[model samples]
Target: MFPKTHLTIAAGATVLVAATVLMSPSSNVEAKRMSYALDLEQGSVSAPAKGPASADEQNSGEVKTDTASSSAPTSGEKGQTEATVAAAPSEPALDWQAFEIKSGDTLSSLFKAAGFNDGIMLSVIHGEGDADKLQRLYAGETIRFASDDQGKLAAVELQRNRLKSLKVSRTDDGFKGQILTREPEARPMFASGVIDDSLYASARAAGLNDKLTMELTDIFGWDVDFVYDVRKGDRFEVVYQDLYLDGKKLGTGKILSARFINRGDERLALLYTDDAGNSDYFTPDGKSMRKAILRTPIDARVSSPFNLQRRHPVLGVVRPHEGTDYAAAPGTPIKAAGSGRVISAGRKGGYGRAVVLQHGDGITTLYAHMSRIARGMKAGSRVKQGQTIGYVGSSGLATGPHLHYEYRVNGRPVNSRTVKLPDAKPVPSSEMAQFRKVADQRLAQFNVFEGREQQLAMAEEE
Candidate 1:
């Protein structure tokens, strides 16, 4: 009986131990799991297991806790969680294709090469006003295309130049075009040169381009004859505008002011525009730089001077030479001395091909010995100053290719070299003050540039 009781007690104790192990807090194994919900719009992460209190619940001054449970969430909770996830918006991806225009390449061909059809090209071009720019494409330009994920063109951009572009973008209604322009920064620059052999050579040595050099000559051509008056030591100084884009020099703009020293004579010119929007070069004292007629009709050396009694080279007899002869290469262009009406344009007895111009104030000019007259130059046709009238040739009574130019006043021949040219109208008294103000500023700049050049020369010599 004692053995039976001990056995029973041991069994009872073992059962109690097994019950304690299953019911104790430490013995209860809780599996720790986490769930994440991404808020894509806000770019944040939310924990579903221990989410913050709801806004409505908090406003009522009550807190709702998510009680721990081993089962799945309720149907209402599941629906709310799914609604939060579906609120994010999706954006489509864009693909870009770029093409460089080549010689003989058309918009149609470029579009086809990029895997686009003619219909797409036509729709984009015919939709709006900007489509016209696509038709004016030139070689060496670039066009970029942007398309959505569905392969529909979203935008097109044409880079016209460094400072201009044309853009076309698709809208709900259609495509719209816009022209974009960027302003270039202007910087003041100075250039000075001393003539050693020729004006062009000296200008090039002074870092002047052909365009700027020509402008310089034109500005001072009224006061000095470039062919006859330019001496070996003549000097020039100029202040001009240098255009730049993105810190790189593109080209030159305009000559603000300049000075020319020829044969010990100094001449200054300033550019000014009046309230009437007329721009012209003027002297420091407000006098106009342009005259009624240019000094020479053609850029040629004088081969024969005006002589009363000279032995004619062609006829070999003493004859009165009434006009100055300009020696030039055959086919060289001859320009009209001033604006006038063509009185005659045809072949004469001794002057092979001749053109006569009748100007204002009873002044007339004639050009003879030409290879051919300029087309459209006929009797009664109006001609502007500096217009080409004919070409140089050894026609009629001539020894070589030359232009026999004669300037007459009231039917009497006059020496073109020594004749007093009529000056253009000066600045009116009402605008003199304004003109002087602008002129003073430009002249100051010109002086500054000249002084700097002088200092540089002195430094170089030292």
Candidate 2:
């Protein structure tokens, strides 16, 4: 059944094909030629194949051939190939250098020190977005640069702080800028203190910083006089926030809630944010922590008290001293007693450089013997409570540098130290339920801290 002639011809053709392939260049040589073609298309230099390649070269050639065959365009791949050709080339590996900002380091000087030209600096500063951050660089900040083999700026990064950075990268059009931010983790912290000598000392003993101590004073300032009302047994507890980044503590955050017991009177304050995004400290019963007026306009020693009949120091006559005098440094700032509009700001006969503010409910406050009234504090100018109105000085007929402060109701002088200030508006009824929930949680945390402290104290006593 075999056809010898046809079978012999088929075998001869296979031998002829094998001979042609063997006479041709090796697989490596063919791969080199194809690779050269690809390099030419990509505008890259290629070396000519010189001699017979090793087994590794042959294997690599097979891979390259397979890759080329796979990458050959089909009906659907034609558009993709064109798009790839039009796209920009991949950037070369960059050489990065970090520079610490120095006292006299200007942007120009920094660029020059980094081996970059003025053109690159200008282009980066005038980049697409957030380029203004470059102008606000501080002396302690750090800036990093990346350049290509050709010494062209590829990217630049300015570290503003631990959690913020500004980055500028070169694009086909120009440089593009972006601000990068890292959110910190908020960890709840609890601290409690019992006053032994002062609020600051006790707070420090309880591992609280000066900033937190100041905040504690401000939270209870409406009801407690830190200078006078603080007793040996007064205690305080606070639940606050501690910020952490990458497992390292950054600093303290807002005071979530606080409790202060002064002279056996307990006061609780909770931080609450309403639907309108306004935040303030409030009592568990929804009353605001702030008052309409502060108890003292300035932190100082009271030099003179309000007396119905007294002999004036300068006039040497029997005059009714209607105001309290606070002895302070010459340039100590005097704050407004309440939120009001200035009624008068001028020199009086005995009260020089006086500024009077008139508040609601027939209340008026006067600050006199000022070295200089605050700029823009003219008649009809609105001011907030605790805003600086003037500085302390012996500007009037006074014997020393002090502030003469007066509180009046219905045109009658009253003792500023003994007068009671009205409380601020309470939380709105619509948000009272939500406020109570937050207050309860914060109070519970504060109580837990207090309980722990009490247990520790009892153990020590035992």
Candidate 3:
């Protein structure tokens, strides 16, 4: 009996040693079994297993993580999991479609092409806040839209340009729209060039766009005759605003100051705004750069001049030509020579379609032979100076397309080309101090740019 008991005891001790070895900390299976829960939900661990608190938990008063657990995430794995959750988008993904606006494309047609009906489009068009701007859609713009799973229009965006857009979204009440605009960073820019062939050619060589070139001419048009006075040595210096978006040039802004040298005579114009928000170009001594009326309303050469004893081109008789005739292409815009009220707008005997404006100081101007009158130009309607009243056309008894312009003072016909134009009002006495401040600043900027350009030219010459 004693021998049998000894053998049984020895076998039990061996089995106990095998169990301890399987459960040891060094064993891979044991380490996995003792792992902590890596996933946490709602800022807490659910159904946590009771264990001794780690040093971290003891100091921070937080739940302890089972470091011995094989399922516990490593530092890298923990970071990755947290990042993924953070990176998850809050809104659902959408499939957007883009459509480019072409010529003659209407909103209805674009909506139909995008698999939508006119009803949806009308709703978007009738949306709030600048939604009416969509009615005047321009070519080369883009439109993007998205729909829900139910095929209902969810959102629409009109990309007018790179920096301007309009976005409309679906709401319970109705579609709401908001104009989105990105302000471009404005940087001062300068350009200078001497005229050899023409103002446009020299301006283009100096990196000035057609718009800026025209503006430069208009700034000095009151004092200089660009059509006849510009010489080969005439030069121009412009300090303007260059707009940029994301380090790329978007376009140009206003001309801050400009200097034009015409026929060896230099004229400078500085832009200024008064306390009442009236903005105009002015000379250094506070003289208005604008004249009461334009010397020549249109930018065309004089085909016929005002004369008292001249032979008529069509009638073949010696008659008094009271007005000057400008030769231009058909459909060229004719401008209002000065701010005035239209005394007459319609056919008048020898004059085809004519518009006569009655101005202050008993001055009257007439533009005859127009293809069509601009909208809002009618008898008793007021017009601003430089506003387009009609397009060039041979409406009256004429040989070809031309504008017969007449300017009169006190009911007496005068030579529109040779008559001295009256000057506009100068800077108000109350605003002279403010005007001087702005003038000085603009002049300083202009001078600095001019100096820089001269240095550059000298360096190139060397």
Q: Give each model a TM-score.
A: 0.70, 0.78, 0.73
Error of 3 at 77 (Å): 18
Tens-digit per-residue lDDT, 367-427, candidate 3: 9989888999889999999999999999988899999999999999999878888999999
In candidate 2, position 139 carries an lDDT of 89
Q: lDDT of candidate 1?
A: 0.85
Candidate 3 accuracy as lDDT = 0.87
User: Which 10 successive residues of model 1 have the least lDDT summed?
Assistant: 24-33
Give the root-mean-square deviation of each candidate in angstroms.
14.3, 11.1, 11.1
**lDDT: worst 10-residue window of model 2:** 33-42
Q: For residues 105-203, write the lDDT of model 2, one tens digit per residue.
A: 899888888999888899989989986577677889999898877888988899989999998989998988899999999988888878999989999
The C-alpha stretches of model 2 lying farther than 4 A from their native spots are 1-93, 458-462
Residue 328 lDDT in model 2? 100
Quick one: ranking by TM-score, best first? 2, 3, 1
Residue 197 accuracy (lDDT) in model 3:
96
Model 1 lDDT tens row, 320-432: 88899999999999999999899999998788899999988888999999999999999999999999999999888888999999988999998888888878789999999
Which residue pairs in candidate 3 collide? 34-69, 35-69, 35-70, 352-396
Please name the candidate that would achieve the greatest TM-score relative to the true structure: 2
Model 1: residues with Cα > 4 Å off, grouped in runs: 1-96, 118-133, 146-149, 154-160, 163-181, 327-331, 393-401, 453-462
